[model samples]
Target chain A: MRPGISKILAACAAWGDKTAFLDCSGASLSFAQLHELSLRLGTAFRHMLKGATGRPIAVVADRSVRCIPVLLGAALSGSFYVPLDGSLPEARRRAMLAAIQPELVVGLAEGTSEAGFRYISVDELYGTLPDADELPPVDGDMPLYGIFTSGSTGFSKLVLKSYAALMSFIKAYIETFGFSERDVLGSQIPFSFDASTKDLYTPLACGASTLIIDKGYFAQPGRLAELLRDQRVTSIVWVPSALSMLSRFGVLGHISLPDLKRVLFVGEQMPVRQLNIWREALPDALFANLYGVSENAGNCLYHVVEKSYGEDERIPLGKPFPGTQVLLLDEAGAIIPPDQPDLQGELCIGGEILALSYYNDPEATASKFVPGPPGVGRIYHTGDLARYDEAGDLVFCSRRDHQIKLHGYRIELGDIECAALACPGVDAACCLFDPGKKKLTLCYAGASGEAALRTHLKGALPAYMAPGSLVRLEKMPLNANGKTDRVALARRYCGGGDVP
Target chain B: MIESNAMKEQIISILQDILPGEDVTESTTLADDGRIDSLAVVELVTEFSIAFDVEIPFSDLVNENFNSAEAMEAMILRLQQGT
Candidate 1:
């Protein structure tokens, strides 16, 4: 057996009957029960895999205690698990499954009969107890999981993570956070997001309990706070948007969480204004701002918020983790001199925890995973513009791509453009956010207004993707790269100029 | 009774203030019509709980119980009766 797998099993055995997972249905699994379930599930998964090498297993379960054992069972069976969020569109889910060509799909839903794959329901997997000796040893170098990133260039790319990389990240997280048996970790991140890997696995690896938060609670902040206090949750990893909503509605002010020890916020830019509220509310807890892309398993840089930062300063991305190296590089891929701290450059990450590659997409893998300086190995080009401040902390500037973060959702402008083009009478369209007004505007070349366009967009896109306003345009400006001049468009639409 | 109709009007006004769009009446469903989201529901429930001095569990804050101004008022009255 692999060392990491052995260690995980040993920890589960040592923890014995202590509670390991709690679902929204009030179902709790002790460590011993979880271990036994995982072993049986692993045996069943191995039988299903039938000795296929590097096969992808798709898991379509909602947030539940069973998700952990299923994911771990897939890993133990030497199969990479691909978590598909049930909330996504069926067409998008089909596109992902078609791209990955998963060998096995496990879900609780009924209508998942796709050709060329074996579908096993959670009920069947849990009911069938196979012999423990049938479980095959998993390889550390084999792929453990694949998380899909909202691809900017048309198609979603699956970032493949190896077992060794996952173990390395887990080790780093435990060392930094000091997780133990007494801690009850709250998980709010979707399984598809890389943030869940930290929230779900790190606790189990350290013999701590994991509290699974229901999706409904996140949408409703009052219930979420109640759950936090009721569960006696000691830690949580969430995006900044959730924190912003909690503060804006005064939920934190109304409810007191006395057991929360650590709060890690990631996925988007952390607003200092909101962070201050959380710090004041949970004065004794540690607040960390983590920065990383899906290409690096989870987080590579973390900034622990101290009590002294006078609320006005923007939080830095802080230094790299123990096994990670962060390099600021120019457009030509050369490292910027350390003395020149003011120069903005793309932040590149190099470490053992770097993801394997973009699954089935060699072209993208080559483009993103480039060779670093001699002997530094492969590094992921994050495409994020940042610079080292005078205090040697990395400060984010903006994204090089056409990605815009509205509220808390990551929306690619191209996706919005594609959706708009599908609308009737829309020849071409460009969507850009007006930060000053907090409104997203769509300028189309053909015809535009709130009536026909809103109806068209409502059918094509999600509720949040619909533009708050629409403007008529003659043509979109193009730059030297032949791409839409987003900067000029932002200035023209947002600067209060007359529409054509 | 300190004007039951006035209390209903006040609750509707508060709901309109919290939720931006959509008309709110005694019969309007809070969950439907997109008038109140999860966060808004929590805020509204907290405001009602504090104003009425009732301990309302989060699980009870559902569409069936507090879907409308009248329903919420009835819930508050029941809690008052219990006390």
Candidate 2:
């Protein structure tokens, strides 16, 4: 059996009547209750799969009490789970579901079904029991879950995580952070993203209680503050945008969350201005900046915010966890010496925390997960550019590709350009990222109105992935090689100028 | 306050510029029609705050106020008058 799920099962036995998960409406599932329901549901899954292999079970992972047990049940059935975003556009969600081609879709209701997949409602899964005597066996190396991330090539990619990789990271995380049963976690991220894995599994690993917050609360900062204050939520792992929203809305000045202790932000750079607002309000809380990718099983490095920072200054990635190795490689693939500290390199993560592989995409997997030079485990070549700062902290510089992180969501410039080209009356388009302004711009040479292109792009992409600004030019500038001159576009259209 | 029609036209122009292809009108449902998402909402708030010279606090950010350009115009007028 996989050690992580077993650890969770043991927590269920130990915690007994204590609440394991709670939703926004005060609906909850106790540890014992979750364990019992999941095992029975898992048995039903095993029977449904009939010992099928390599087919993932997709769950519409909404922020509700029902989703937790279904995810756990998928693991118990000796199958991995892929969490689909309930809030995404149907076209986008359909594209993701089609990419996975799941064996079964465990949805909230019965009417939801994709072609060639068996559909089972959460209620139906809960009601049925397997005829088998025991649950299916789980191997540690088997995939635990698959998450969808933005692909530079216009489509989404499925990143598969193994039971061993995630569980090992969880153990290392718990040991490094000193998490325990006394903590109450308020989860901020949706389960569809790998970032939510920390919130989903940490409670079980440390015998803690998790308050699964409502996504709607984010739109209302006052309500979110009240939930944190009332729930006495001691710890929270959130994206910088969430924290910045709360800070920008002055949520801290209106309410005081005395019980809040640990504040962790990941997925994007936490602007020091927003960090200062949070730090000034909650002086006692431990603030940490976490850095990692979905392929690295959550964060491999974290930096405890020890000193004050300027508003525009970039925060360091700090240090890696005990079991992880963060190495930098130069342009020629040579290891940049740690002592030099001046050379920039692609951030390569070396550790067991690396994911198993991209699901069914060996070519893409081989390009990233390469063998380490001498006696080291395989390293994940993160396309992120980085360099060690004077303080010896790993600081992020820029992306080697056109990949950009806005509001903690990854977006590829080419992805936006592809969606833009699909719009009627659009011919040529180029996407640019302005790091100074921290905004995305799309310049196109198309007859379609800017509003038309925005609407078309919105239908194809999520809100975060959409360009913040659009520019129309009579003709897109091109280089001698006939490629769109992206640098010239960035130089001209990057000052938040009027769209023309 | 600025002329009601002029303000509405300006708001439509802003929406058209930001959104690109929507048939935004005085009564178009911005939020319901998915023309204005969360990120777009932020852009709208910033544009309104700058153009109207009024602070559009998050508390005032509701679908009712932003569902239509007319609602946004009324909101701007109210905030402008209060100031």
Candidate 3:
């Protein structure tokens, strides 16, 4: 059996009264406060929920101390939480709400009400009282939380994670990275994404402090630099885009972060051109590349930048974390020989840290998560391509499918095509991604122009999902299979043809 | 000194190059209108820095400075005078 998340939070509270979290505005919560607040909120949730467990509770995850308790309260109430970004487009937000079908929507403060769903404020949850301080019994196998990731099916996929998976990965992460109460973490990613889980939970698990940097700081790298220096943030686990933005703006050259020790980046490939800029600025800081999918609880592989890489060299994906097994298999499901460094195969992850499943989508769950050969049990078949390097380190090659990562958000080309197809006057649509330019282009055989299609896409998709360019095609190229020839479309649109 | 109207026209030309087919006017709110995202902003910074021979500091990257073509021209003029 595994220990529940409630027990972990209680233990962290008992550890010490160190600061657990602080938002960009300097508002904070101590460990004791976090525990106390969560308990109070959880008591209210227990009263509201009664005996119902594992029910998805949607939380408006704004950068407030109250949201932390709201999330914890869901866990304490024997229910899992799903954090929704307050800034999401209405259509997209409605799509997620429709998918989750949440019974309760937790808001940060009072006067929070949506049309259909019952809305309850986190503050109200804290204010209201239940007779007892006790929480409902919880099992470690129970779902702890669910986070939405990009789905090839156009709709966002809610990946449900269990308490066991989270705790196991947290333990591995903390142990591998040598994090303790002495360290101060600077938050980067928003609470809506899985990357933010590391920032939010690390403090609770390690009894350390977390400084939540403001989202606006990203736009102004100088302000971000100021926060880094002001907070004395020792470690920051961020996405490559965030780090790259700072390097691109040349902010690292202007500022100094003396206390910063560990610089961890994940989500997308770190451009060597930008990584070198960071290395030159913070020579002493240990830069590391982490690789994982939201389908897995967190990161599975990590590589410390021990040596200098050339400006164009692709960094190695590195070895698996403790207890995690990474396998590379060819299209025929046969294991690729490790010694053959040149042989590329799809990356497969097998471990306890794997997510329970995509919430309420067993079809998708079955499609990706399959039983491994004999003893390996269940393994998540990642569509990411990989190859072993000369040093036996796992190196990333290219994506096996049309799935792409732009600005650290995973996107599927199929999803874009689906959105484009849904638009009126659209007959055929193909989305092509230019990796080097980080630009998305659309080639469509349609009556709708760029503006019309863009307007339709704005309603259907998020800002990042919107195509940078749209071109009209008299007819779509088809392969021998009679399917839309995406490669030919990409070559025509992304390579040279500027068919406006 | 180049006339302010000419500078504004040049700025509009640059905006047109960065964001094709968008209505970029003097009163247009670039950020609110969703014309200048992070990627476009980066390109704008590079373009504006080179076009105006002025370094666009990250501090000056706020919405007020880049919300309109007129705003961008004013900023360029101010930076040109080393103010």
Candidate 4:
């Protein structure tokens, strides 16, 4: 590995005045400015940490140009940066901050600041700093960013990713796709999401410019289409839901994005219905399916959609990205042979793209990321089940646990259950996802009504994690194991049977 | 244009069908509020077209137009007028 950071920052000098980032709010940062600003900001962070390195620095991530520098700057501080969604319910952000116990929080709202941690504005971090040569060398193994993923426990697990993992993944991705300095990437994923790493770094790596579309525009697909067309965005890697919304509303029929060259979707399965719509509209663009987990470096597998599939056929996870290795493990922890077609096993990955560890959670880290053979690094057991097809392509079967992906967000059904149980009137809560409807319904034997439970959940969980609907049960059914009979509850309330 | 009670009631009923939670009323905040996600917004746009026979234009699909049942009623009426 190229020691990641020095090469990335040093290569920027040639791009000079090229636009590195452009926000929907009309803010733009050039490559030279981004290079200088991050170093200055890094110097400020060093001062805040009293010269201590490898500390976690929290950035109040909003969808804006300014937040980009903060992300890069935090890494330049010799510490890992954790992007916290500022718009999340204050309680949700609080719990994450408490888990990380960051050295300083950048751009946190004044009134919301906790006393134990120091807070600083993004503007304040732009101070004069040491030259690039003066800074200490950082190895590829050094932690770069920490991403929070849903945990079975109500608290999210912070996955600490190293510089080598991110750089290796980005290098393989942009190179395979042929991203160049002239390309403009349409960025849709939020800063806090691990998938967004590709956007943040791809532009920096290849001297491309990523134009961030406003979050609200997804609700109004026409505006989103307009932004892409007008800005001449050539490439985009987004969650399936955002792309589906455009086709669902017939927004594509009204607009034309002739500039778009390639479109990649990840996080969740993309229904063939919407994919067909996009393929018809942009006949020249490339459509690809990607598979990844928060525990890995954004993504590990990808398959470019070669032939149009029928609505009934599922998209294959395709092949592993360059520099990454994916394997299947049977229940007994034995590696499944690639020749065994149609034999299902839990998908596991090993290579340079694997993350360092789940921060502050040794048990989770140990259980999920088992040690790999001598030089392969640790292997990540993705909790997702898959099998090799006749063509040697990986086919996604189903999730092994209650964790589900909705609208590209990974959600633990147990995480919602844990939060529901925290409510005063809620008792014996079970959350179920009706995959047919793409909705989460929480069944509970509780004193509170739907409105009250919704209010409680709104405060406790992020909007995306909150159950779409609520059901009241006299009491939860119990199985022979003495656990809540989730199957029975799901059938009674969410199936053809009436909720009552 | 004034938001008629019938149109407002239609919008609420349509939203309730898609979201199916607590009762939606004229004052319910739909757009920015966490209650309605992006997928739900697309469904609402489709539902409005079927119910009112008016295609919501790209320019009129902003949050202000869908923030509440009353707001959607007004926007529907505006689109219905060929504006």
Candidate 1's residue-wise lDDT over A448-482, tens digit each?
44478788778878888788878865445543222
Model 1 alpha-carbon drift over 4 Å, by segment: A1-7, A110-117, A307-313, A337-339, A402-500, B1-83
lDDT of 2 at A267: 81
User: What Cα-based lDDT does every candidate model obtain?
Assistant: 0.75, 0.78, 0.79, 0.79
Where is model 2 chain A poorest over a 10-residue stretch in terms of lDDT? A474-483
TM-score, every prediction: 0.73, 0.80, 0.80, 0.80
DockQ top scorer = 4
Q: In what order do the candidates fall by DockQ, top score first?
A: 4, 3, 2, 1
Query: Worst ten-residue run, lDDT, model 1 chain B?
Result: B32-41
lDDT tens digits, residue span A397-490, model 3: 6666677899999786766776776675665678888887889998886456788988989988889989999997645665422246666676
Cα-based lDDT at residue A30, candidate 4:
95
Q: How much DockQ does model 2 earn? A: 0.21
Separate DockQ for every predicted complex: 0.11, 0.21, 0.21, 0.26
What is the lDDT, from 0 to 100, of the residue A5 in candidate 2? 62
| Predicted candidate 2 versus true structure: per-residue lDDT over A70-94, tens digit per residue | 9988888878899987776677677
Which CAPRI tier for candidate 3? Answer: incorrect
**For every candidate, what is the interface RMSD in angstroms?**
12.4, 7.6, 9.1, 9.1
Clash pairs for candidate 1: none
Selected candidate, larger DockQ, 3 vs 4: 4
